[model samples]
Target chain A: MATVAVENYLKHVLLLSEGGEELVSMGDLAGALAVVPGTATAMVKALADEGLLEHQPRLGVRLTTRGRRIALNVLRKHRLVETFLVETLKMDWSKVHAEAEQLEHAVSDEVLDRLDALLGHPRQDPHGDPIPNRAGKIDSQVYATLATCATGRRLRIVRVTEQSEEFLRFAEDSGLRPGAELSVGERNLVSGLVTLTRTDGGKIALGVAAAGKILVEPRG
Target chain B: MATVAVENYLKHVLLLSEGGEELVSMGDLAGALAVVPGTATAMVKALADEGLLEHQPRLGVRLTTRGRRIALNVLRKHRLVETFLVETLKMDWSKVHAEAEQLEHAVSDEVLDRLDALLGHPRQDPHGDPIPNRAGKIDSQVYATLATCATGRRLRIVRVTEQSEEFLRFAEDSGLRPGAELSVGERNLVSGLVTLTRTDGGKIALGVAAAGKILVEPRG
Candidate 1:
């Protein structure tokens, strides 16, 4: 059985590496796991020894095929659990991520499949993170963010890229969730602020870094 | 947060003691937890020190009021999860006990409350085991079992006392679940056999010990 630590390590690697192929720096991995750099290094070495990852000496690490398979499954469990918590339980969108973090490891494939069916096989979680399918495949398409999209043209939020719960609560309050229509009113990178104009004629200002986490697509 | 092992130990102690006030022998606790006697003793001592339980050296252990509160909460999560699996997810009743065992530890109180409401605040799980409420109170009403019910009396199965997966599967196939109507056709203690006659005119024989686990009530 994969221990929670092992599952978490692999999942973090899959998340850090785009398309599960790029090398993940030890510093970023340690930051993601909230572990000391040495601790992260030791775990990555052990995983590499187990053929779950390729630890490139001092360069970095990437998951092996088998490791990606396990990581994808854990991701599936996490996102589906989040979806269940929010959609079925009517829990707060900002709170479900933390709840799902603990439940992801405990949920079996059987329970996850049942939850997936119950949620009508959602493609994305409440935060708009794409759910990896059972075959370890994910939708990796990129979308423009508030920091990059054309200003004043109608754009719909596609994903919130859930980070801190505080950020999520703020996003929810601003009506910035996925499928909500908005356009950039102002993007002053040097000032590190962006003003979003909602379809409801509401305006909200966010830090440029925060604005970058909200993925969006232009409305035709 | 209570660790999974701590939750299991407390729950099992509550189960072995009919009213959660009786002394549960170390031998029974060990058997229920599948831990060696030494391990059970060591854990009991730790719990006693923490004021969760009272351990009688070389004899047994019993839950303190604080311990009972936690134990009841765990039981509530377990039975409610089992009910959701069966009544909502359409999972096989025989397999849900094991699934609930894992979920009970992972489910948060908030999520459980939502599930309880979603399940219509069910008083009992599909197995007919009473679910504890938010106040940590449980229904402990006693009911006669097939081994003790009057022969040829019309009876209704109220609970099956879920034990093993094999037994539950067998019970399901025998139409011996809760709410099923049946009658104790015969019970021969000397031969250690009990015959159950279903209302559909089907008959089945079980060991006296097995019959004792099937709680039933005389249908007036």
Candidate 2:
């Protein structure tokens, strides 16, 4: 049985390796986990010894097939728990992340299956993050950050990279969510702030750094 | 911040001292937590120093007011999570215990409040355990073990004491649930087995040990 700390590291690495192309370095893992590079290196080695990770010194760390399965499972649990917390518990989206972080490691498959049934097997969580299916497969979306979108183009918010609570609250207050259509109204070359008009007839301003983390696609 | 282990111990002791009763012994704490006596002693002392517990050598430990509040909050979280796991997640009641055990300590007040709202402020969990309210107040129930009931009396199952998977499966197969009405037909003194007839016209055999752990009340 893997410890919760080990499971968290594996999940973090797998999440960072989205698109199946990127390799996660020790520094990246440490940054993601808020730990020291040396700590990340030691943890990576431990995971490698447990046959859950493949590490090439000076390169990056990748998950083994077994490790990937566990990581996906953890992701699935996290998303499902978040959905449950929001839809059923009436929990604020910002508050559910921390609770789900701990619960993802503790819940059983039986509970996950039950939760999936109750939530009608949602494909995405409140934040637009994909929920992995039972087969450990995720529905990947082709999206670009709002900062990269051309001005005057209409795009639908698909997902936002979850980072800080302040960022999530800002997004929520800005009328952003999965499936929300928006038109880029203006862009500031100096400040990189993007002004957007939502389909709901609301206008909001987003800082360049915040807009850069939001994934969107052209609206049909 | 209380460690998970310490929180668990405090919760256990608080639960054992229901109705603002007296202190709990180290041996009792150890038994409840499945730890050794020496370990329980060390933990009790630590908790006492933290002002979460009042320890008397050779006597018992009691929760401080602050400790009681924390314990009740943990209970509230656990019950809410279990309800979410079963009602939303479709988790088996038996399988939810261990998962809820870990999640209870990690969930925040915000999450708990939201979950409670989602569950419509449920009074009891999947296993018929009562949930504590926001003020750390729990509603008391007047119910007795099925083993003590007189034969030929009609009663409805109120709760099950054991949360093991096997026990839940047996209860499900036997048509036992929170509102399942049954008539006790006969009791085998030698084998300690009770023969019950379900309202749905099914005959079931329950071991005396199991029956003794199941709480029920007279049917209306």
Candidate 3:
């Protein structure tokens, strides 16, 4: 029964705090939401009052268990919607995120379950992000950022950081979809650019920032 | 950029208007949204100010072309989500409507188109409600209420008017689905009950109210 804005805030806080034992800072939330610090403070206080979040002035923000559940539910809905949009609708990978972002908050548990079944219960979304199970458990897949892949190493794209649309479009055009294989050809230490040869025989250069956003697993 | 509540109003107006010939009353809107007449009036005025609707005093209200477009978009999103939830996630039919209702307002065109493609450009939802096309056009399929069907006529269930979970469960339990075949075995003039024989050789009795909600087509 959470409002859309409230759900969005919970999702952001959960994503920011993933795999970390730290509280998200007010400035961080503000920057993420692109809101003024004062606005973010007001919203955060509202969320805390709703029992979805905990706020400590100097310590930043952490989700209560209830908050985390809601966050995971939203994430599950988003990823499932993305997968449905791409696999069933044949939508361009670049276009599904925004649509899924809107849909993730609205679907019911019954719809979510049916979509999961229809997609054959995919472990990862189109972006290679894990889909949380019914019990809210995320699969712990070990992945390395493209920036850390050694030169000459063969790797398979596993996931990409959900950042800007531009980043997603670049990944799509460069054949960086999940399960695509690439061989690291060279690395520029100064610029953090990495040249890679894709399994489809395509070649591309990725800057450190871009490479860092791409998660990969070493290929045998 | 319409809010969920606003989108709901638009959709309700569009559906209630049914071919844009009649103006929808505030009483009708209130009944649809389960709100008070004053609340409906306030909302209708707000929508009028936004230019999504036209109010004709005692004649009630109607959608402007722009309003129709918005309603279609919301409908497209709703049907697509229902299709996705049922086809992909394996959700029960009864559970998808409420979820899709919320999602219809939030999903973008990109996601909607993708979902349409993923669902193989379905023309109808699970309940046999026609999905609007991309141009905001809905196919007008004629249906006869089961209560009015001639006795001894073979027919097929095409759609149901009630979207409630209890109603859906009852329909399902009675072997009534979109394509289920039935014969009007008997009709009681006094009690207004209809007895139907299912293709699977089962007999079920439907009250006049329930029969009125079911739309059926003659079997070829």
Candidate with maximal lDDT: 1
TM-score on alpha carbons, each prediction:
0.98, 0.88, 0.88
Candidate 3, residue B96: Cα displacement in angstroms equals: 3.0
- List iRMS (one decimal) for every candidate: 0.6, 2.1, 2.3
Off by over 4 Å in 3: A139-144, A180-203, B87-90, B118-120, B198-202
Q: Which whole-number lDDT from 0 to 100 does residue A12 have in model 1? A: 94
Stretches off by above 4 angstroms in model 1 are none
Standalone chain B TM-score for every prediction: 0.98, 0.93, 0.96
lDDT of 1 by residue, B54-168 (tens): 9988778999999999999999999999999998899999999898899999999999999999999999999999999999878999999998888988999999996589999
Tens digits of per-residue lDDT for model 3, A69-100: 89899999999988987787677777778877
Candidate 3 is graded, for docking, as: medium
What tens digits encode model 2's per-residue C-alpha lDDT throughout A148-173? 88878889888888746787887777
Predicted model with the maximum DockQ? 1
* TM-score, model 1 to reference: 0.98
Please state the CAPRI-style docking class of candidate 1: high
Give one digit per residue, the lDDT tens place, for model 1 in A19-55.
Answer: 7478999999999999999999999989999999999
Error of 1 at A45 (Å): 2.2
Order of candidate numbers by DockQ, starting with the best? 1, 2, 3
Residue range B113-204, candidate 2, lDDT tens digits: 77787778899999898999999889777677878888898898888878788888888877787878988899897988888898887888
